[model samples]
Target chain A: MKKTLNAYSEQMNQLMGKAICLPHGPFSELHEAMRYSLNAGGKRIRPVLMQLCYEAVGGKEEIESFLMAIEMIHTYSLIHDDLPAMDDDDLRRGKPTNHMVFGEATAILAGDALLTEAFQIMLSDALRHGGLERIRAAHILSEASGMGGMIGGQILDMASENKTIDLATLDCIQLHKTGALIAAATKMGAVLGGGGSKEIAALEAYGKYIGKVFQIVDDILDAISTAEELGKPVHSDEKNEKNTYLSFYSIEESYAIAKALTDKALKLLEQIPGDTSLLAEIAETLIKRKN
Target chain B: MKKTLNAYSEQMNQLMGKAICLPHGPFSELHEAMRYSLNAGGKRIRPVLMQLCYEAVGGKEEIESFLMAIEMIHTYSLIHDDLPAMDDDDLRRGKPTNHMVFGEATAILAGDALLTEAFQIMLSDALRHGGLERIRAAHILSEASGMGGMIGGQILDMASENKTIDLATLDCIQLHKTGALIAAATKMGAVLGGGGSKEIAALEAYGKYIGKVFQIVDDILDAISTAEELGKPVHSDEKNEKNTYLSFYSIEESYAIAKALTDKALKLLEQIPGDTSLLAEIAETLIKRKN
Candidate 1:
């Protein structure tokens, strides 16, 4: 799994580098700020998931741009979420956040640039693949990343900050904030790989289950992982007075929930008639990950 | 001209309202912030131009979403530009800025949501028209709004603050910051209206010229118009220590320059075989306006 992930990461780094290259103009600082967050060396989970889902559906050829676009969106979200006005985090992926390095206004513009550039990359790449495939992929991605998905989730999380909330609200936050983008990644892979409705539906379900597992396991890791292991500080939720699965339940309970979600995802993979072993492997690794 | 602008503005308000409606959930505040900025009442110049270009190129139905998306992009840009970390404006369109009313964090998310929703609205509308049009329109809009476009221009504007820059640098700032999206609007109208390549090219040229006229006129307005007439504070560029056409030239010279650009745009309109009278009239009104 490490070898596979490294290969995907290497390819993604190259693609992202090319996508973010700005002209030697006056606004080169924007490009630099964008690259600072993008190249900060976290696991390329979203891109890898997109690729795995595409391959699982027997797709090969051109999926690099879509993968790159998804990662840009993810990176932008992280950048904005780390702003002083948002999460107020100093470090991300073991390095200073974009706002910490670039200042507040530049960080804001950098995030905005990344979000806008993601669509440009999708559209430019669409011209290569006849057009509809990239359009459909972008559609799914935009829906996931927009108010109905990630942004919506962020507002809910922000509104409920430093306050107690019910499980339903927590679910709402997690589903929109993280789950929607993950689900979009898989669904886009299915559509881009030419999978039919059935394959798309199955992969979407798999994505949803794994998304929940991913967040819960993240909570568990934050509670236990050392600073070195996690890169950033541990128990950030506690520091921020933010609610999490750990705040509501014991570590053992979080682990059980993650395990059950992973199991459900793996079972859904079985129903899809493709070589979904890579997906299953990823899901297992994701939940058990230490960093 | 008022009647024509009113009709387009009315249609745009409806489309924008529909596009921004969230599915009654935890993100209602996000929705409200977005609506506050969007409904704050601007001239809707971009959407009106887009629709005018569409009509001049003979397009009839299903352009509403594209028009709405363009306006949303414009509104999002305004919202972000008004952030305390950015332009730090207290008033926009005669009312408190998004950050003033909703807090800085929520304002930021609102801007982010509007930008994302622009794409979602385009893609959803595209699905009905077989897809490529929305993708292409989005491509133009994103390119005009991204790093090489509006955001790029903004960074340059920010970096050059309280400093003197040459004509070339100033032109670059204006082109990227304001001209690009206006150009995108007209070009999109041409493409969506089914104009051929020649017509599209002509409209693009027309858009570029009119964009210049629009900004120069705005600088003129800022220099000369009253707060009540402009609906915002006047002499803002001077207060912000920013450069403008008036900074380099007399008011008479600025007016001459705007007239020349408007004439060039009108000449381009002559090449297209559509009813461009409305576009010509708008250009004249825009350049001659007191506010």
Candidate 2:
């Protein structure tokens, strides 16, 4: 599992490095800012999940562009979420956020550039490949990132700030906020790999369960971890008065919930005929991850 | 010409009103904020250019989605440009900016939503239509709005603020910032309308010249028109210390330059073997408009 994860991560790093090469132009600073956040290390979970799902469904073609596009979307969301007008965090991954290093205006443009470039990359790929599946993948990605998905989740999260919300509402927020992209990753991978509808639906369901687990674990980490350990400010959810799993249950209870969700995700993986051992390992690792 | 322009404008308004209809969700406010700026009366110039070029190139399909998508991109740019960290303007089109009414966080999300939704609309269309031409058109739009184009131009514009830049640098900024999208409109229209490469190239040249003329006229209007006449703050270029045509030339010289560019654009139209009378009239009207 570790070997596969490492291989996928290395490939993503290489592809992303080439994806955003700085052009010899006046606006190279925008590219630099975009690279700054993108190169800042995260777990590479989304792209890895996408690759694993693609391979699990017996995908043979290279999907470097789609992998890079999903990560770009994730990175752009973080940059904007860290802006002064939003979470206003100065640190991400134990380093200065994009806005902190590049200033607000450049950071904003960097975020916009990343999002626009994601579509540009996808559309260009579609033009080259000339397939409905690629276009469908791009459409799924856009829907996940747009109003009906991440953006909508963000709005709900922002509105819910400074107040406690019920479990159903919290579920709605996390489902769209975090689950949409995760689900998109698996679903796109399945489509791009030419999986049957049943396999795609199963993986999508698997993704949703794990997305909930991921966020619950995040809330738990925020409550218990130190700033240095988490690579970001601790107790941020509390700082923003956000509702989390911790808002409704104790740490142990939250852990149990995550475990149950992971079990559910793993069960869905079993229904797939392809090799899903890597996906199962990912589900286990996500629940036990400290950061 | 006037009759055609009004017809396009009315169609655009109706389509745009339907394009962003409020979704029944917790985040309907995001939709409202998007609709606010989108419905705020700009000249609907981008979509009109797209449609005129579409007709001129003998397009016959319902391109309502692309028209709405282009306008959504334009509106999103405006919302972000008016942010406190950017131009910080309180007024746009004689109404309070998105941030002023919806607050900065929502305004930012609204901008992100519009940009994402633009692609969503386009990708959805591509899915339904299943053609390489639509995909090519979408790629053009994305490139125009991405780093090498509009956003890149924005970074140049921002860097040039509070400084005296040369005319060459100013031209680069305006060309990317404004001309890219305008050029994309005509080029995309030609492609979607099934025009040959020769016709597409000709309309693209036409669009680029008009884009330059459009920006020069904008600078002149900012220098001469009142807030009431322009429906937004005037002399804002001076306030921002940004370079414009007036920075290097007097009003008469700027007007002459715009007129010369308009003539060049009109000549480009004449080369295309299609109905270009409306395009020619648009070029002539652009150079003489008050707002």
TM-score of every model versus the real structure? 0.96, 0.98
- Find the 10 residues in a row with the least total lDDT in model 2 chain B: B1-10
lDDT tens digits, residue span A179-278, model 1 = 9999998889888988888989999999999999888888788878898989988888878787899778899888888898999999889777777877
How well does candidate 2 score on lDDT at residue B269?
A: 86
Residue pairs in clash, model 1: none
Model 2 chain A weakest 10-residue run by lDDT: A1-10
> What DockQ does each listed candidate score?
0.79, 0.94
Please list the residue runs of candidate 2 whose C-alpha ends up more than 4 Å from where it truly belongs after superposition. Answer: B1-3
Error of 2 at B18 (Å): 0.4
Residue A277 lDDT, candidate 2, scale 0-100: 87
